[model samples]
Target: QQQQQQQQQAAAGGDGGQMTEFSIALPAACAQYIVGTNMVNIPTLSKFGAALTLLRDNISGDVVFSYKGSPSAVAESRTLLMHGMNMFGVEIRRQQALLQEQLQA
Candidate 1:
């Protein structure tokens, strides 16, 4: 009976739960611009305006450049922090497994 109850509880719990929040921070300037203006323009560089001309030249559909730029330093920092959190989570999972093993033993 006790063994059956344990199995039932285990089945109910299943896998580890979902992550609540996910975020990536960007450059202060870019972030501010995104928040404030919400508009972007990409200029044609060549004398003939080849890029814009080509985009317009396309017969079927229009071409678009999705420009999202963030300062490298801030992006790097955020990546590092996320990596640290992932490492910490791995360590925690290992510790929990060890504890469970010891309890079962």
Candidate 2:
């Protein structure tokens, strides 16, 4: 009976991986911009069996990004998300500088 119960639990995912979560808080301005972007559709996340959620944190008036999955998956997703955000920021800054130069010209 014990062995059968264990098997049943395993089959039902009750004894599966330890679900892990990672959360990041972003400034409201950046968070609003991210909300309109396609950053959530990361293909690598599905490959790692991870999911991401974004919400406005009312108390802090910030944006909260939550990643849930196995520990390793969550870590990898965090790394990817941060890298993407950094690259996007750099590009946006470069474009703004270029536009400013054009305007001054």
Candidate 3:
């Protein structure tokens, strides 16, 4: 019965195969900052047929981001997220330099 059910699903689903899940944990503050600044581009993930889920750990003050879709889609989503984070880091450095210059002046 199990084998039969698997066969049926494969037949119904075609060559697309199964969906994959990807997840990452980030500091809560960092997650909020990026999301607030629209750095992560959530809609783009949806466009790729990937669903995004967010969970916060109150005690640890961490946030978990989960994405589910085709393996390639999830991988691409992760890559985009990392790129956004890199941009965020650059912005932070820029802000700090501006602050230092202001204090000097």
Candidate 4:
């Protein structure tokens, strides 16, 4: 039951990984809308152009996904998670910069 809960959390965070048998199977329409044809959605009432600008300035700036599990697990899965996020339309390099800042803080 505990494992299932953790799996749920991972999937909710867009982690479609097998290490924990987790994934959110987004519908085709939803997936396309999220990643758009060329970009990810900021998902606000603002216009798409404004949303793009906001994301450009800061993606997940006020938000962060912290690792709170086994260090060994993170060591093994961090690269995979990064790759998966990149594939799913996240601006990972930028986010990584933010993550580094957070870690330093």
Candidate 5:
């Protein structure tokens, strides 16, 4: 009977368990846009995708110019904003790449 119990315990992998799930809250601004109150999906998204989504949602609203501006001026401002967004996208990509490399190591 003791031998049989030992065999059973061995087959059961010695009681080591599965990983646990974790959850975190979203920031106020992001929570407002998120469909659900839960933020479990944030960690699952690719860094670049998350950054792009953030940029898209942020700039979706009207772009307010302080004073009366020419068409060219408004276009210039928009272009600058887009350039900054592109930089953010690049940074996110780099961060993801570094994370992947670390995981492999």
Candidate 6:
């Protein structure tokens, strides 16, 4: 299991779970638009996808993630992936709030 995780980390451009150097191949469109003028359409995207879009602001066309040996590794997470993951949480809260408002109405 540890070996498998090492391989995954390597594939993700991290050296033994540290992302000091690696290649992140995003689509040409994403690369251009990550630093482009067009507004990202977030509503149509999945929460995870939307969060990744949010990372475009923090990352200078460079996305990063970190993993500790913890079972969940929540603390070791970097801003980009954490923000991307937070997108889902935000979406869920928004939906719940909307549902509550509708019920109140």
Most TM-score-accurate candidate: 3
Residue range 1-95, candidate 5, lDDT tens digits: 97776577557754222222222333333323332223324333222244335544664433222212334444443444344445556766898
Question: Per-residue lDDT of 10-61 in model 3, one digit per residue for the tens?
Answer: 6788323678877777776666565656544566444422222342222336
lDDT of 4: 0.42
lDDT of 6 at 2: 93
Question: Candidate 1: which stretches are off by over 4 Å?
Answer: 1-70
> Model 1: how far is 28 from its true place, Å?
26
Give residue 6's error in model 4 in angstroms.
Answer: 20
How good is model 4 by TM-score?
0.24
Flag regions of model 2 displaced more than 4 Å: 1-16, 43-61
Better of 2 and 4 by TM-score: 2
What would the TM-scores of all predictions be? 0.34, 0.51, 0.59, 0.24, 0.37, 0.28
Sequence-dependent TM-score of model 3: 0.59
Number of clashing residue pairs, candidate 4: 0
Error of 6 at 2 (Å): 33
**Ordered list by lDDT, greatest first:** 3, 2, 6, 4, 5, 1
RMSD of 4: 15.6
Best by lDDT: 3
Q: Which wins on TM-score, candidate 1 or candidate 5?
A: 5
TM-score of model number 6: 0.28
Pairs that collide, model 1: none
Model 5 TM-score on a 0 to 1 scale: 0.37
Predicted candidate 2 versus true structure: per-residue lDDT over 30-105, tens digit per residue: 5544443675466544342211233433223655566676566677778876876786688789989999999999
lDDT of 6 at 93: 83
Residue 14 CA displacement from its true place in model 5, Å: 80
Model 6, 10-67: lDDT tens digits are 6786665552322244433343333232223332122225335646555554343223
